[model samples]
Target: MARKVGIYTRISRDDEGESLGVARQREDCERLADLRNWQAVKVYEDNDVSAFKRNVRREEFELMLTDLRAGLIDGIVAYDLDRLARKPQDLERLIEIYDDRPRLEFATVTNDVNLGTADGRTMARVMVAFANKSSHDTSRRLKRKHLELAQQGKASGGPAPYGWQKGDPEKVDQEAARHIKEAQKELLAGVRIGTIRTRWQEQGLGNPREGTKRMAHHRVTHILTNPRLVGYRTYHGEILYGEDGSPVMGDWETINTVEEWEAVCAVVAERQKSQPGRSLARTYLLSGIARCGLCKSKIRGQTNHKWQPGSKGARYKYQCSKVNGGCGKVARVGEPVDELIAQLALEEQRDRAASADVSPERRWPREQELNDLNTDIAQLIEAEKNKSISVSTLLQVLPEKERQRDELKLDRARFYKEQKQAEAKDDAVDLSLEEFFDLPIERQREIVLHSLSAVFIHPSGRGKRVFDPDLIEPVWRE
Candidate 1:
């Protein structure tokens, strides 16, 4: 009997077009498996995906774990540890599988020179951390490059933003230019912003996609507010670091005369001052979760108007002191706002529970398949040790075994995580929006804050609030 082994390979988006073809990875793993006399159980491949965000997206990798836990494979092989995961958190999880399971082992072609040594494990972890940081740094560098291109009036990468097409050297989007002029004229005439958006859609102007197209209100607002339309560029919310380790506004480039872009700014300012009150804001139970949205700082509760006649009985509100002291904005009362939010949250909770039911049997792997694969991998490892395989032979075979082990471990972790989450879902809670509205204000507030993530409130007294849907959205257990 041969050792039941699994192989895993991953190629990031940057590696996809380069020399790191999936076939090359498979070939390397296969040649190694042959030398170790291990049976190739399966090969798990995730292509054009980033390892940094692997935990969130890799479903195939999760399935491999189910196979592993059921004893489908004895070990996993991978080209390298980073190929399994770039993030330290996720790498630590891989280490946990070996630490927790006595029958299991993890091997990497490049890094597992000695699995029995503490120093080897430490080196592997350090390498993973470096890889994770590199991925993050690369993302930041890419964003900077885009900003630089935008400043130079070049296309800022993705899908040409409604008015432009690819391969136009001059970057002159004639169609977008026409729409911008029309929108500018409407703004100058003091036409209602929403009406302008409707008109654009009716006339099939500036629709990014085809077929019964309608311009979104937000899209219209963005176009009317863009200084770029007037040949002037404004880097909205550009991140800049100040000298004292604080962030501040940086340099502005004069892409067009201020006078030329005056109409666009005026329209934006007017719209900002007159937006409608948001019902969604009132609906979310938890308006402030971690920090004050306005001040970007933690919110604190303090009693106010305590000495006043009836006002003394009022509860404390959540506000940002930084804003209240002229550094930020006014504090918002948490009680009524939280009450309204709770009502909305309950409705979402009910819906989520209704969607979360799934058959448990379908979620796990077949017992027989798992046992067979485990048996095969065990045999392979036994043969390697008995033959006292040469260093060259071990190097060739180890990676495939490591990949298989890692894949199974990932699958098992995902299964357990999902099971835990599913079990945690509250199905008994009846949370319809109407039902929520009927609940007492305090109960409503309790549900909202507990269920909702965040609520974005508009500055205007009449402005609407945006709710974080996760709190109320029902979990669909499948």
Candidate 2:
């Protein structure tokens, strides 16, 4: 009787995401079975899956073993011995199956093997070992190549990051770059990552890695913290450095200068260390911005439920609570306070827009210091290139200089961010002060905090009959 055979085929990778490798393997295995006049009863395929990789389970290979144990096939045919396994341990497993069913057949098109005998199993083990060595050598070569590319400040091939175009890593997506720059400024100005993510999604920006039009908070953090933002090439999340202790700047156009990137990174690191986890979204328009004029404590939104029958009397108001280090004497109806503050904030924005200064005045003394540091760094690098400064000496001297420059830049970044917040000439919320109610409370709260230092809710006379706008005093920021 002709032996029933299971044809097994596999490929370590499908470069084009197609199973072309396994298709050729299957054709070869079928021809071998035909030559042997064996009935090809089954085809087990583990396409685009690695067999040599440690802990990578080949599902079809395991199923074929199960089938062999159940006496479904008397023989196994593969295109090559290495296609079945690249590890000697894996070969030993198949040998054990052969030892159990001593009459069961195993053969490959590339190599004639008699699995019935111990010598054939030993030969298979040797071939598997050689295949394993080949895979290890290939992996090492690829890793070395990638390290070389990173050292030269080249992208090692993948989808481009958020602010760059795919395939053309050097080209910047202007719109995305603008969004990223705005986000960096916003974050440095004390806006939460969640807030930035909300605005990005609202503006139809997507996380390309996730292949969706929805932005994620973590993705925002990743973009902000990435070395690519400042034009440094990276491999495995680490910035590549040259022998002279200088970073390997990439070919891509950087969104932020090295100083700006370092400043933003430092701020984000401090925030992470202090907070350690996600913060709850702000639900009130002026929770932290409004203060009690009585005790000068921040006010919070409060809801009072009236549990009376057939009465719709749930009142939402802003109040000062003793629990939050506030005097318990202050209370105000929320609607008018929100409206009055919103109108005042609007007028502040319009006034800033109509001011004579188009851009905020920068401190040139500090700016000159930063520029001097850059000149020093450039001269140091030139000395290294000319071999006047040794790599060891450059390494020792450059970092301290860079650190001092970074500290100055961090302070500078803070100054600019605060100035921008104080002079918010652009309509960020895209709504008039009267239309503040239409915006999210988070957005409205952001505008309020940026536009004013504190909104003081003073004590009104007892038995108040009407809301008074004069009772709410807004202390505007200079």
Candidate 3:
């Protein structure tokens, strides 16, 4: 009786999006099965996947093994032994399976294999070892070549970044670059990065790396945070620094300054420390902004769990509780107070234009100091590299300088965010007042943070259930 055979085929890449190469392999394997007088039961193919790379999943290969173990196929046919596996562990599994069934047969279109015999298994193992060696050597060479290209600030041949023209690192796409800058500004101004991502998707602002397929939340953050936007070469998410301890600037026309990049990175890092998706669960309009009038602690918004389905009571309220280090003295209903606070903030914006209290020329006074600190640090590293300073001295000085630089970077980031918020508040007032309620909670809170400094909720008398707007005191910013 003819043995039932399963044909296996694989190709590392299907550039044309069609499995034509694997299809040819399948034909050849089926022909081999016919020559051996075996009935071809099924064909398993893994396309655009590497056999050598252990990380790459060979789904069809695994399924064929399952069928082999089930005795559904008494024979296996492939184009070559190497196509079966370049990894030794994979070969051992097949050999073990073959040992379980003495009648099982394995053959290839390119080579005759009798896996029931020890000699055939040894030969197959030797061939796969050589194949594994070849893949390792190729991987090493490619990694070296990639490092060399990155050192020279050249693309290592992939999809272009979102802000740059495709396949051209030196040229900047002005419109795309503008969007990146806007993303940075929006992120620092307290707009959620997810919101920016959705906006970009709606606007069709995609690139080969970003918008072409999908713009996930992490990918959107990557575009905003990558140092490449400021004309620096990066590899595997790390900026490559030169021997002088400075970043290797790329050939691209820069979209943002170093200061802006530093600031945005600081903001991203700070946000990462808190629950990143907390904004999505935000229930109250003025949770963190509302304070306890007695103890001066931020009030949190909470749902009144005491009210069941049929109960008539406040569903949510802002409370200053002792558990969170508040005096446990103030509580008020959520919706009416939220509406009044927002209204008061809007009135503050309409009554007076935003004032810097100083001219634009006087802003950012510490920029020069920041530059000088960087210059001094770079000079020290260069001095140490030239043997002008000893390693001991270099290490001693660099830590403190680095600390100061990091602290200054943080201070600058905060100042920039504050200034941007003030500017955003001006823009907020420019919008129709009716639109404020339509914004996301985070945006509304951000606008209120700039327009009004604080909302002091004075305690309502005990048993006073009526909603009172007079008890809420809003301190508008000067």
Candidate 4:
């Protein structure tokens, strides 16, 4: 019986208009198999794949390995030893597979090794080491080339970020740019990152990493945090600092000012510190916001089916957490208090909407000031680079300007977010909120927390009495 054989061919990159390299490999492998009188049972081709890249998945190569292990093939053939693997560990794995099946034969167009002999195994390992060395040399050369590009202020290769184009960050993809800005506004308006991700997924936004329509919250957060959005170059998750120790500007239209970017970063960092585990997955609307006016302790939510001795149904209340431990101050019901807070917030929102109109004159001059500040920083950096000023002088000149810019940016984010919320259609009653009664819990929670700094519940003197709204004192956030 003829020896059953599997032919494998791979090309690191596809040539423009054709894949002639893999075709040549296939031809060479087939000719070798024919010379040995082996029956070619399968031909596996992995195109546009790199054997040297450990993370890259080569589907056909994996399938061929599986078939070889399952006894479906008696031998393996490739164009060369390097075509089979470029990593030492991968070569070791192949050798182990061969050792498990002593009858298995390995052949290449340029060389053949006897897997059954110790000396032959040593020779194969030496050949694999050479291939591995070549792969490392190529990687080093590529890294050097990338460093040259960076020194020349050029884009390092790969897909550009969502709103920008590859090799030309100056041109913005308008659709993507709009989405990016809208997401920022939504984030500022108290919408959760997870909620923003779901909305973007439904809008058919594709993630650059996975090329999928749906994205994770961390991905959303990354887009929000990227310094590249403000026209700075970044490498390995950090904004590139020049020899003068200043941020290197990219050749792109800035979506935001550096101050705005830093302000957003500050807000996110502060939130993470204050509420270590507080997430958009919060269960209650008024969990920590409601307080007991009498004891100055938190008012917590609870449900009881027998609160007044005759009530047959469960009742939800925002009561003092220490009701059994000496504090009698409590709100007998949750709904009425929630309604009162919501109504107060709604009135304020309407008033603000009616009064505020941000004209171009009011908005443009501040933006111009931010641009000038960035220019001044750049000039100081350039001066330092030219040895005209000391590093200490540059640092002393820029901190005050940078601080002003950050404050302006934060103010702009807050005002813009408020304007967006005022203009957006309020639909808190849909299942989009997921929890609470008669409204979306997130919207209600945002309104409650934003409008009233504190909702203090005072006890109404011990006896059997009706739940009164007068006993609740609301403190305004402003």
Candidate that scores best on TM-score = 3
lDDT of 3 by residue, 107-217 (tens): 988887778999998988889899999989998998899888888887777556778776575788888988998777767667788788778887877552322555778
lDDT of 2 at 219: 81
Model 1, span 349-371: residue lDDT tens: 66766787655534436434444
lDDT (10s digit) by residue, model 2, range 1-478 = 8999999999877644567888899999889888888999999998877887777999999999899888999979998988888888877888888899988988898888788897887787778888999999998998999998899888777557779875587898888888888777766656688877877777667454233656767788889878898888888788887765557988888888755676677768777888888684776678888899989988898876653656555356898999998879998878678888888887777676677467555543598887788778888998999999899998998899999888876777676545544433244534675576765565567677667989899999778448888888999988
lDDT of 4 by residue, 1-478 (tens): 9999999999887634266898999988888888889988899988778999878988888898899899999989998888888888877878888889988977888877766667878988899899889989988998888766665556776656777754465677777878887766555546666776777787766344334555876777878778877877776677776764456777667676654455455556656778777775555567677788788787767776466656644367777765445275455577667666666666666565568674542243376776776777778878988999999997998798778867866666655444445433232222222232443355467656655788777787878867677887888867
What lDDT does each candidate get?
Answer: 0.56, 0.79, 0.81, 0.71
- Superposed by TM-score, candidate 2 places the C-alpha of residue 16 at a distance from the truth, in angstroms, of 6.7
Which residue pairs collide, candidate 3?
A: 206-211
Sorted by lDDT (best first), the order is 3, 2, 4, 1
lDDT over C-alpha atoms for residue 198 of model 2: 77
- Compared with the true structure, the alpha-carbon lDDT of candidate 2 equals 0.79
Residue 317 error, candidate 4, Å: 6.3
List the candidate numbers ranked by TM-score, top first.
3, 2, 4, 1
In model 2, what are the clashing residue pairs, if there are any?
A: none
> Considering lDDT, which of the candidate structures 1 and 4 is the better prediction for this target?
4
All models, RMSD in angstroms:
28.7, 6.5, 5.6, 7.4
